[model samples]
Target: MTKRNKLVFAICAVIIGIIAGMVFVFFNQEDLINEDEAKAIVTERYGGSVEAVEEGADDDIYIVNVEGDTGTHKITINRHDSSVEAIETIAKPSEDTAADDSNTSQEQNEGTENDEPSEPEKTEDESDTAPSKKEEPAESNEPEILTVEQAENAAANEVGGNNVYSTWSGEGQNREYYILQIVDGDDEGALVSLNGVTGQVNKVVYLDVSDDDYGNIEQLIYEANTYADMVDGRYIEFDDEYFDEEEDDDYEDDED
Candidate 1:
């Protein structure tokens, strides 16, 4: 053969081979499976025997259809491990099934009716005979209000904020409580607690003291005026009255 003709024939053969290979792959793109493993997967998912209607390739996924008591399900198994990846139910219960359920319910109702004893109906006159009067609900008791002195004492004792603190009593949630204010050298804040009660400081929190002079007990009383409005009364008391007495001894030594 001529060189040109031989080259053309070789090229044609290569093209035909490529086309055939493509067609084979397109048609055989399903996973190949073992018969025993396929059956096991179906038994595990649906509790029934599975039939392989079609064979799949090595790389493709195997699809199996399982028939159950209620419906037919489609399950896909992996060719490599025989593990079930997906399952879908295909059949639905028919109208005759629904009608049978209704009939069963009706029979049960009829049986219950025959077993139960019916009570005699009362006449209109019996219902009309004297309706009993319902007693009114008792009035709710008001919470006791705290005295001004009691509120002041409670605020001075709670442990928080500054060394020097003051207290004021007020009414909240229908209950009497005391608001405590503390003033350290730099930090100033306040707390609220129930009057004469331990550990109930829900309402009042610490107040920020921006002014240095306001740390005095008198200023805390003025700032806590709002708490005073809610209470029976308000008052201010010093936390450290003996500080001056203690300083007097030191002052006498300086003179010596």
Candidate 2:
């Protein structure tokens, strides 16, 4: 073969190889995400540091462990689409009972230390001149109030919800109530208020699913829970009774 023809044939072979390489990459490239990306996604959604990320049973799925504000949870993500598939709570944060006790003790100690300096021993004439005062009768002790857990249970029982997103205790102008943001397995969410002392459900305001243009119930729950955080100011109050007759029926059944 002529030298020029040989060179041209070699050039054509190289071009074919380059085209085959490009086609292989286009077909075989999967949009698989990495561990760092999984961590970022989880942190953004859950607001916590990602502890670890591991491969799931399937190559396209990743399980990310996160220590979030609410609890330690494992978030499952689809690596291909970078979508969160499931979030399972491993454990909820425990109440800092020790810290509360310490604070109470500190306050008591401060009160004791801050007692007013004893007035110089009053002279006999001064003591005699002090206006005679009658001691007021001692006040009676109040009844024990319901605990947070009991309040949550009462609210959940009334609403048929299983998951509690947040809870707050406050005294409004009219009454003292425990407010809870709860959601059922079906993504139905509601804000519930109940009497703190009596454990009676006072009101329930369900999330407006009809107007959920975003179609993300979990996000909706997060937004709805912010209402409970506004304890210092006014909140949604309801005077109408909520599921009281049903509670009465349950009590009757228990007695039977």
Q: Judged by TM-score, which candidate is best?
A: 2
Q: Alpha-carbon error at 212 in model 1, in Å?
A: 84
C-alpha root-mean-square deviation, candidate 2: 39.0
Tens digit per residue, CA lDDT, model 1, 1-256: 9999999999999999999999887665444456666777678867855645444564456678777556677787786667777888877557787788889999999999999998878789987885879999998685445555556555556544433444444444445454545545564556454533333444454455556645575555454544444445223223322345657988999999
Q: lDDT of all predictions, in order shown?
A: 0.60, 0.68
Q: After superposing candidate 2, which stretches have Cα over 4 Å from the reference? A: 1-30, 97-256
Q: After superposition, how far is residue 74 of candidate 2 from its true place, in Å?
A: 0.5
For candidate 2, the per-residue lDDT at 15 reads: 100
CA RMSD of each candidate after superposition: 21.0, 39.0
Error of 2 at 100 (Å): 7.0
